[model samples]
Target: MSETPAASVSRRRLLARSGAVGAGIAFSGALTEVFAGTAAARGLGDRGYGPLVPDPNGLLDLPKGFRYRVLSREGDPLRSGEGRVPSNHDGMAAFGGRHGRVHLVRNHENRPTAAIRVPPVEGLTYDPAGAGGCTALTLDADGAVRSERVAIAGTAVNCAGGPTPWGTWLTCEETEDKAGTNGYTKDHGFVFETDPVDPRRTGAVPLTAMGRFQHEAIAVDPRSGAVYETEDAFQRPFGLFYRFLPDRPLGGTGSLRAGGRLQAMRVPGLPDLSSVQEPGARFGGVEWVDVPDPLAAGTPIRLQDFGPRGITHAQKLEGCYWGGRSVYFVSSYARSAEGSAADHFGQIWRYDPAGRWLTLVVVFGPDTGVQLPGESPDNICLAPSGGLMVCEDGGGAQHVYGVTRRGEVYALARNRQNPGTEEEPEWGEFAGVTFSPDGSTMYVNCYTPGTTFAVTGPWAGQPGR
Candidate 1:
């Protein structure tokens, strides 16, 4: 399928007309009175895919004719006859495997202080002190687990990463904690490539050329082999969107280690574009500024280097996906108090390489509740049926929302795991929302109370279509 270009004003108009704006309206120069007429203007009071049917298992709530099967959970014995399944299930990628099977490389976002750890395995670990790594799972055509094993170990905070076109998962470490300070022998914050077909081929090499910041996720451009990375750091020294232009096209393996030039994004004329504008606001004349030192020797790359170069900053840049020849990324949330020009519930940005223009496609207004269309979308996946499945990471009830090509929003699933106590019941956020190669099954992870589920339903009959 071809990419939806930034110049496609028709798509934006369709999104605006489909009530994709949700309860929150677009923010104008003034935040208070910005979305006053948005709900009425778009007639978006009754959005979403009907009502969600409460699950009897109390784990997840879904709409009618939908259900999920628990494929794996923390503490489950590994099929490899080694360690148990690690905790803090995070990002994952599913690939078509041999014999009509599917292989998934899942990330464990465990830190040194975590209770359960990804056991240190010989040749599969990076730092012995780190507990974060990845696991490989093989599922049959019916989505039944055939085998599971530790793919990589001894890493730190394997938060989120993207799949390469050549059939490998690039797991990213979402931390910059220096080695020797936190009992770590080597540096943290680096991306590692894993081969699901052969766990033995999984090396402990770090893609240092991709810069050393709190790397959140990556999306690779198949046409040019350029890797787009996102930083999840939030503070006075925020994160900048990065592009790693490899010296050579990425191939079977070890191509990332060949070294590359790391560059940060700079929108000319809008140097300080806070990304807090209304939905459909387009920014032109985008440029890429070379980072003198991608290694960031003893200095934070975002604050010390890119910040000084006038690189445009984003608030908590998270999941990114390559689809339709364009790279779509998420900025969890931006606010004036957080150094942004205006306050926004969340923002989704699309970068069109063909036009070299960055456009704001989806923007959540000031409604912080999950009952709204979508808020704080973290990990994103493009549906095979031509829509976007976004995992919401927000304060209220967490949900997985579906955004149609025309910008209609619908609730696909909701977190129903209750702790039996009164400590804010629905707190777990959904992560690793990905579809199988054939698009029959969808897999996702619940961050807290870590559990991985395989969801299958009438996806084609969903509202996004």
Candidate 2:
């Protein structure tokens, strides 16, 4: 497969199509009301193809005209004869394939003791002892699974990753474990590239230059080939947003392994992103500090002192994607109760690499209640219909929320499977949200039981399509 650029579009057009302009509104602008107010009062009645109807089979709830097909599930036999499918599906990416098919590279956030692990394929296994890796699934033109196989193996806590312009998935290890910890034979927190089309091209080698830390997700700039990554650290000192400038920008497959420079973002006086409570807060002239120790052999990258200019950090730094010539990242949530500087339900930030400025695009109020329409946004991807599809990792129920340019938020899909008893229902968080290259199908993963679904519906009728 060749390089596949992100779904880039004109910002002005995208905003206009979504009805964000001329109204002094931005994406997710009405999020507060959408959650706090009633459905009819919030104008969601005619939005998002109507409210999601409960699924009869107790799997996934979708709009009246929308239906989902189970692509793969945990414990399922692989077509490649590589044992059963792994668990803890997280981030993923979709690429175009021949004969109207779509190729998906999914992450398995498993540990060393996972019951079912990505089979350690000979050359693809980085460390046979590691249980977390990635699997590639090919879907036919009709959205049926054509083939399934292990793309990479022997990695730990493969949480989330981004797609490269060269049509490959960058699987990130959300860990800082050393070789001695948990029986790991090698240091495991690094980014590895996987080719969905040709596994042979991906040697399962770690991209050491990308830094070793708790990586959540990454988004690659098609223009500069610069990769923006998020760190999902929950403890004190939190996580830092990083940018990797590759030596060979846009150099197709296996180029990131060549080398790169890693740097952390610093906003003059702002240290923790959670402190910013209001939307449209813009910070200009932001600076990047070089990471002295990308390998983190002694100290983690976020903990390393940058001298006089301390590195900026945020709590629960998650989803990231490159679109509209800017890199968008998310801060899932922060709380004073958790040692964070401030509190907020969620925040979506836009960073303009060209201008070296950052803006708080969307900020969800401090609503801890599970009734919020959208909360704890993770694994975000730009919707083909001019907005965004956010995977919810919050409490209560789990949903894939869709945000239009008009800032209307609606539940696109809800998890109907309750792992807990009927009296105490539990819904798994949705992750790895992505649309097919043709924009006909939306692929998302349920993290707990590790189920992947391909949703098809009246996408063209979407508000901003």
Candidate 3:
């Protein structure tokens, strides 16, 4: 287990994605209140995680049962052409249409910045394009979005992915350019695979060892198609954390172009352990260090010497999900690597591949005595009862935080979905969270008005299970 190579991928152009997933999906909304639930702001239901409640930035104290509306924001007018949906939305996936319909596929982290550039829309993936990236709505089943596609075009900052069991939507590319020092002609970090429901064949193909850098969430073991990534890695400390394997196996979904094995995440010993509250031995508690050899031909092994011990609660570990078998994600950033700032906070670990281990359950510290009125906690999923939704990019108190499975922490909705006056919730704020295999309905997406929302009520347990 050993690895390192934070970004500068494109060993010479490789990753590729195709299209297929069109049976029908059209759910649009503008609702206000439905079978909602409330917990009176963190009651936590004795940890059964019941008393359910979310969607109450309603008045702004936002925490009780939870309630929210505004299905598709941003310039509005979704049919894919005109007005909005080009914001900064990130990570999504819902597919499963025809009658029991719902197809979402979204991700748009857009960050070229210049008074808000991103505007070249239309089945994106660079080709005379420049827009903010990611977009593919096509909801239905009480959510209504009929059609809207830009699957993955002209990508650069399009982040978050992992959703392909033959279904589509892999869109990642946390942007890291060095085209001669960064004018970024192309060769953006990698990972692109889409097909929301036809958008002229959403073009983009690049998975290249899955290293690159900055790629926020991705968890697709699918029983060994292998992929477990997360890296905001922030500040050039070189930002690392990954694992991608697929020379061909669980049928990882239509050709990424046979290029697998990339690893990083070492904690094995400690170069003198420098405070993450002095953690240097808890390493591999959540075990998954395999950067060795990757077919490079043996010996390589380093993968952070086997993670966890201090300095790993997400230097920016954006978001992740695989569901209870083990993967359970979260952690927006509590700092480490010298700047320091982590006395045990922002956590949710839970990794358990048949006893490999990594359980922290819920420990975002200032003291689970609990005090998160502000920020920290980017993307996490698994709620219906086992509780935990996190997502508070926290600005003017940006929320989406929910915790259960026996550790209550409420504050469900209030992203407002960015019509953008910026006063608050310049965007709905919830980034890269998905549900709807049968969780009834509760789809949220927003990184910058790159919208996608569908929240129905009476949510039963086992979300994302």
Q: In terms of lDDT, which candidate is strongest?
A: 2
Distance (Å) between predicted and true CA of 164, model 1? 0.4
The predicted structure with the larger TM-score, 1 or 2, is 2
Backbone clash pairs for candidate 2 read none
Q: Write candidate 2's Cα lDDT for 418-455 as tens digits.
A: 87888977678899999999777899999878899999
Q: Against the hidden reference, what TM-scores do the models get? A: 0.87, 0.89, 0.31
RMSD of 3: 19.9
Model 3 lDDT per residue over 242-279, tens place: 66767884663555556766755444433211233321
Error at 424, model 3, angstroms: 46
Q: Select the stronger candidate by TM-score from 1 and 3.
A: 1
- By TM-score: ranked, best first: 2, 1, 3
lDDT of 1 by residue, 1-465 (tens): 001233123333433454443342232222111222222122222234566888888888887777799988888788887788888889999999888899998998888887689988888889999999999899987788999988999999999999998999999998888889689999889999999988777578898998888888999999899999999875655788999999987665888889989999888656444544766677877888888778777788876654544778776788888766578788776656557655555677788888998877676554433354445668887765455678876544678876554455667888887643676344567899998887778899987777899988766553422
Q: Count steric clashes of candidate 1.
A: 0
Off by over 4 Å in 1: 1-49, 306-309, 366-374, 423-426, 462-465
Q: Rank the candidates by lDDT, best first.
A: 2, 1, 3
lDDT of 2 at 110: 87
